[model samples]
Every structure is written in C-alpha cells, then in structure tokens.
Target: MIAADSVTVYRGLEIGAAKPSAAERARVPHHLLDVADPAHAFTAGDFTRLARPLVEGLQAEGKVPILCGGSGFYLRALLRGMASGEENQVEAAAIKASLEARGAAEGFAGMYAELVRQDQGSVSTVHPNDHYRIVRALQAMALHGRPWSELNKEARATPPAFPGLRFFSLEVEKEELKEYSRWLSGDQVQLTIHLDKEAFISLSELRAIRSRTPGTKTFGGLIASLIELGMEEWSLSNRTATSLPKPQRDKNFSL
Candidate 1:
C-alpha cells in the first residue's frame, strides 16, 4: 500500500492522519508512509517523483501497487505527469529548505526584501504575510534559473509519468458532500470518546474547537498528528521500555 495522503506522509502525524494500523500493514506491505518531515511542504510534485519509481518497480516485479488515500492532487500528478521542463522535486524541496533556513538565519524581512528586489512582480502579487507563496516564488526563481516571469507563460503538455498508468475514482450518491460538510462543520462523526463512558467532550467544546482550529477539515488529520507526536515523544523518552525506531526519511521503502 502506497499512502497518497498529505498528512500521512509526516512521521508524527499518525492517528489524526488515518495511517494504516500495524496489523493492516503487516498483512500488506505499505510504502510512502512516514517517509517525510511534516515541517517541509510535501508537494504533489514530490509525491510524483517518489511514487513513480515505486509504481514502476512493482510493475517490473509483476505485482500491482495499491495507492490508497484521499490526496487527489498527489494521485493526479502521479497518473498525469508534470509539465515539461519541470525541476526534480528533491532538488526543489532542498532549495526550498535552504531558502527557509536562510529566512531564519538572515531574517525573513531581509529575504523578502531580496525577493522583492529580484522579482517584484511575483512578490508584489502575494500578500506581505503569505510566507508559503513567498518561499515558493523564490524557489521558482531558483529553479527557473532566472526571475523570468514569462518563462512558464508558454503552453506545455503534461503526459502520464509512464506508459501503463491508470486512474480510478469512486463516488457516492450526492457524494453526501452536503451532509459530510455539515458534520465536519461541528457535528460529531457518529464517533464517541469516553473516560469510562462519561468523559466525553461537550458539544460547546466541539464548537469552540471547530471555531478555533478552523483548519481541521480532514477526517483524521488533527487526531493523527496529536497521537503520533505523543507516541514518538514517549518512545524517545522510554527507549529502554520499547524498541520503536524513529521513522526514517530520505530513502523510499518498498516491498
């Protein structure tokens, strides 16, 4: 199983991210889970770069690879390849990491100033506080080899990453999208928590949480992050009690 979900890629975002259980993984080998640092922005481009090899290698071995998750962006990018002349995701991510590191060391104000100096068009378009776009625009300048905003303006073709790639989507009646949205808006998801059956969070508390944590849009994103971070910390502190290794990054593991 190759997980395509964005949150599940993070090492410490297990419970909230709906990562497969140990028993489930033991039954069927999984790939791409916990292979990334949550601190970094793992783009669809990165997913394509990492997952392409896994899929191709599985085909070479005459085995079908199952990619399961709700990351529509990752799935699409992998099936339909990136546009021509795109930079490799690893290098792009590295460049982004360098830019972010310098932003910290050299002050983001100075970094932003440098960006505005180089590509005022890109820098001017985004809000002053839009840090993600600021770093991304800088990364694009680095990747494009210049601050030429006209470069990507030309039309380009996006082909499938490989010859045999296929895509399948499942849909529900009405997709239940309206109902689901309402539930996510603040209602319980037919799930209950308990401290001896009486220690449940109140509806008001849920409303407050929904209001304050407005970004809890995923079914399990928040829960997974909290549980996995706690587990990782506990394991690190009690190394003598259990033999849980910190999730490894860099290398892509396959069956």
Candidate 2:
C-alpha cells in the first residue's frame, strides 16, 4: 500500500498526523511514509516523481497498489502527471505564506474571491473550503505567468503514467460520493459501491422516489437528488447505531 497523504509525507509528524502505527506498518508493507523532512515542503509533483515508479514496479509484480490517503491533489498527480516546468518550490512557499498572512489579516473568503477573479476556471474545479489548493493555484499562476486551469489542461493532454487505471471512491455519505463523481471525467474512472443490505434497500427506495419526482430528468440532477436522500438515511442509521447506550462495567472489574 502507498501512503499518498501530504501530512504523512513528512517525517517527525506521526503523532499529529495520526499516521499508521509501527505495528500497522509491520503488518502491511507501506511506501511514501516519512520520506520527506518537515522543513522541506513536499509538492504533488515531488510525490508523483517518487510514487510513479513504485506503482509500476508493483504492477509488474502482479500486485495492485492500494493508494490510501486523503491527499486528493497528490493522488491526482500520481494518476495524471503534473504540468511541465519545475515549479520554484522556494518561491511557491513564500507566495503561499504571503497569501496565508493576508488571509489571516483579512479573511480566507477574500483570498478565495481574489483567486476566483484571477482564475475562474481553476477556482470552479476546487472546493471553496480548500484553502491549500486555493493558495497553491494562485501561486502557480503567479510563478508561471499563466492560468492554473491552462496548466491542468496541458497536464491532462499528457499521457497518464499508469494507463487503464480505475478509481473506486468509498464515501460514507452519498452527497460526498456525488461530489467525487464530478472528478471522474474519462471512461477510466468507475464508481464502486459497498453497502450493507439495509443501506442498499434504503438507497433503492430513494431511487424510486427520485424517479417519480419531476424535473429530475437530467442524469446529474437525478444523481444529486438520490445522493441527498441516501445521505439522510445514512446519517439517521449512524445516529441510531451510535446512540445505543454502552453497557455499564462491573464496579469490581479492573484492567
């Protein structure tokens, strides 16, 4: 398994990052953990450079590499290569710090608004709450003297490092799943659903209700509605499961 997480990428951040324990690593071979020093900033480009070869080597050995992490940008870079040009990491860091300072002084909303004005296309692709990517996009545009969206377009045109790759998104709520679905563009992407029988039944009922609703003609609209219903049911089930009272321990019992 490859740990493509940005937080886990740095050394000496195990406790705060909540990285897998030593025992867990011993049980399963893991890569890309503690590969960089905390002092050095790790970029998606750097991650792609390192992980691509490991993934290929694993594939040659007839092993499917499991990429486990929440670093979406890094994962995207691994799957689809980054744009040409060696991004000046030092300059990018300075720019990011400046932007962050401004965000702190003013507000992140203002920073995000400025980014939208600078690169509307790229801003649309990223979530509003994602401050890291927002600042990064602005930094890239400033350094390269081009739009982040254009760079991404160029990157997409380049042949992927791992061809015929499939993506399976595991989301707790369907709304989250639907948002991820937007990230899947080409035929190479596929959705894999794993749910309990009760959840599956709930999803089926939601689908039926969505089918009967008017103005749910478009595929996107239907998907959004079904996901909304599914999330409601999932949340209710989760609450019910967790709300159960824990069994009281015997007063005389001791560890």
Candidate 3:
C-alpha cells in the first residue's frame, strides 16, 4: 500500500509512523518507510525529490503503488504540491556522537541548555531526547550565531510548488478508520497472502476464508479486519506489474 495518504493525515505520531510493518512490506514492495528519524523534520521537499519518481516509475511499470502512511504534506507534495526549502539531511549519527561527547565532557543537560539558549523556537518543537536536533541546532547557531529555529521559521513561510497534481483524498469513516488503524497496528497478520477478485470477496465474508483457499495466510486476518471496517479507496491499480522484484510478482498480481 502506498503510505502517502497514511503519512499525510494521521495522529498519534510514532505508531502511526510505524504503520507498515516488515512482514507487510515483505509481501508487497514499498518505496519509503522509516526514512526520517521521528525527531527530525521530514520536509515535503524531501518526499518530492525522493519518493515521487519511485511512485511514477512503479506506475509506468504497471505495478500498484500503494501510498499508505499519514504524512499529508508528503502525499500532497507527490501529487498536489510540495512545501519549499531543501531537506536538511544532516549526518544524524555524527551529530549525535558529537553531542554525546559534549554532554560527557561538559554535561548532557548543559548541552541541551545551550541548544535552548541558541534557538528556543526549534527547541520547543523538537523533543528533548532528540540529541541529533540539539546538535544541529547548536551547529546552526555556531555557523550563523543565530538559532536553527529562527531559520525554520523563515523556511516554513516559503510556499511549495505543486498546483497541477491530482489528489484523490481517501476519506475514511471515523469509527471504521479507528478500527482499521488498530487492526493495522496489531500482529494479526502472520502470513503473506495475495488474492484475486473472487478470493477477495469470498474472504471478506468469512474471517477464516483462507481455510477454503490456498494463499499466503500471514496477514489474511488483518485484511479481513480491514474489510470489515470498510476499506477506503486511496489508490488501487488494475495494472498488471511487469517490473517488480521476482519475489513480489505474486503480491502485485493474481497468480
């Protein structure tokens, strides 16, 4: 599933961000996930530059591009538009190590205090445990003697470029959406399962439909749960995939 929609408009950040599990991805190919450290600012520009081509390429190959996440800005950037300013792809590991060293020498709390002193605005938005942001804020301060927070304020004001792209926003019914979210987070899916139209309809009515059919059963129960909640049509393709990895052929097509 394309995480574009899921990443666009969901609350409860962490679990929402972790919407697509490893097993789920093993079944169908996914473009981007966990690309950003939750503490870092993952801008729309980043998504446009990195993810847009993947989505388009998959489409060109006649494969299904399931955009399944809750980052609305990212989805908009890919389809409708993008926010301005290049993504600050800092060396998070290096920055964290530097901060850790600073904290060890002077004090971790003191280092954080220094970050606040340099840029209170960014600090307010960033989590305290995010050493990477703290270090980057400090670096930004050292570079210009002004806080990174102030820079972000200026950056956020700039508008993105993407007015012509089409947007088919999936509007999930409230109660159903809640149940679906729960089902997605749960480990109900134990085996990978791909289905045809006949199989899909039959499985929808029977929770243990796979008992009557032969397919990957890992996440069949989860799919059933999602169907019961009423699936929203964000992006589904009738295109038969021609260029996916060999292992993924069965997932994108009815074999």
Candidate 4:
C-alpha cells in the first residue's frame, strides 16, 4: 500500500496526519509514508513520481496495489498520469509556485476559507482534513478562474501508469471512520469514500478503531480491511473489482 496523503508523507506528523500506526505498517508492508520532512511540502506531482513506479512493481508481482488515503489530488495523479505535456507543465509549475507562496503566507486555514468562498461543491467533495486536495483544487481552479464544479474532473491527464489495471471504486457512506469501517464490515464490502467536513476522522479515533477490529494491529491492516474487506479479498480468487472500464475513472472517489 502506498499512501497518497500529503501530510502523512512528513516524518514527524504521525498523529496529526493520521498516519498508519507502527503496528499497522508492520502488518501491511506499506510504502511511501514518512518519506519527507514536514518543513517541505509534498506535492501531487511528487506523489505520482514516487507512487507510479511502486504501483507498477506491485502489479508486476500480480498483486493489485491498494491506494489508501484521503488526498484525492494525489490519488488522481497516481492513477492518471500527472503530466499534461510541455505547455501545461510550464503553466502547472507557475501555478504551483504561486499557490505554494500563498499557502506559505496565508496558511492552510486561510487558504481553505478562500477555497470555501470559491467552490462549495468542491469543498463538499473532499475530506475536510485533506489539506493537499483542498489547496490543489484551489490551484487548479486558479488556472481559468473556474469553480471546481465547472472544471473538467480530469486534470490534464495523460496515460495511466498501469494500463489494463482496473480500479474498484467504493464509497463508504458513513461519515465517521469508526462507524464507517464497521458498517462496511457488517455489509461485507470494500469501498472508497467521499466525505466532507464532519466525515474526517482523527488519529486517536482511528487508533481506537484499529484496536477494536480483530487482527488489525496497524494502519495498513485497519485501512486494508476497511478498503478491501481483509486480505482474503485479495486472494487469487476474486478479480472482479467493480468500477469504470477506463482504468480507474471517477477521479473523486478513485484509489
């Protein structure tokens, strides 16, 4: 499992970022967590550069890689290649610099308020705690002064890294993570989630939930169970992951 979260990528932000616990990582063998310093911000392009190869490797091993996180921007970049050709790339870089400067000056809370003013639909689409997705959406919206709802869901995407790699997009409807995971378990389902402000869960809550779910000792195990219905779901037997045919479409709730 490769985390697509921007904050979780930092080394010392475990609690705030709701990073997978040490025990959870021990159980699931996750990649790309705690790989950056908190002083520096991790971008969606960086996620794609790192995660694309990791997912490819997992596919080569004949095991489907599960992307578990709340950062829709990073997830979309990983699933659909991040490059948008030369001209778009140049524009993206300029936008990135501008947004980074804004974020640095205004702070996430201020930027988030600005985002709320611009796009309520977008504000409702992503998890409230997903800082990267919120700021990144602002960046994209800035490109043409368009609200997120009016912009194309696909953002300058190219080819996906893993072609013929089907995606299983599931929406866990419950708002709270604790209730949501249990609900999914009771129903015996694995799904991705689209949550707004109240839906975001804290680290302590997630840790408590992990302890309650049998055999889930770490973040990897807990998330794995919630997102894929236990390791048995990945058993060589079931290959029918329901979703779009175009290799992980629906950017909002995709892995």
The top-ranked prediction according to TM-score is: 2
- Deviation in angstroms for 74 in model 3? 7.8
Report lDDT per candidate: 0.62, 0.69, 0.51, 0.60
The weakest ten consecutive residues by lDDT in model 1 span 204-213
Q: How does model 3 fare in lDDT?
A: 0.51
Clashing pairs in 1: 15-224, 16-220, 16-223, 16-224, 17-224
| 108-218: candidate 1 lDDT, tens digit per residue | 677677777886665445455655556666787788766623332321234555676556779876769777767656643333232222112222223211211224333
What TM-score number comes out for model 3?
0.38
Global local distance difference test of model 1: 0.62
Give the clash count for model 3: 19
Provide the clashing-pair count of each candidate structure.
Answer: 5, 0, 19, 4
Q: Superposing all C-alpha atoms, what RMSD in Å does each candidate have to the true structure?
A: 16.0, 15.2, 19.3, 22.3
Candidate 4, residue 172: the lDDT equals 60
Residue-level error in angstroms, candidate 4, position 16: 2.0
lDDT of 2 at 51: 92
TM-score of each candidate structure, all chains considered together:
0.50, 0.58, 0.38, 0.47
Model 3 lDDT-worst window of ten:
207-216
By lDDT, the better pick of 1 and 3 is 1
Poorest stretch of ten by lDDT in candidate 4: 189-198
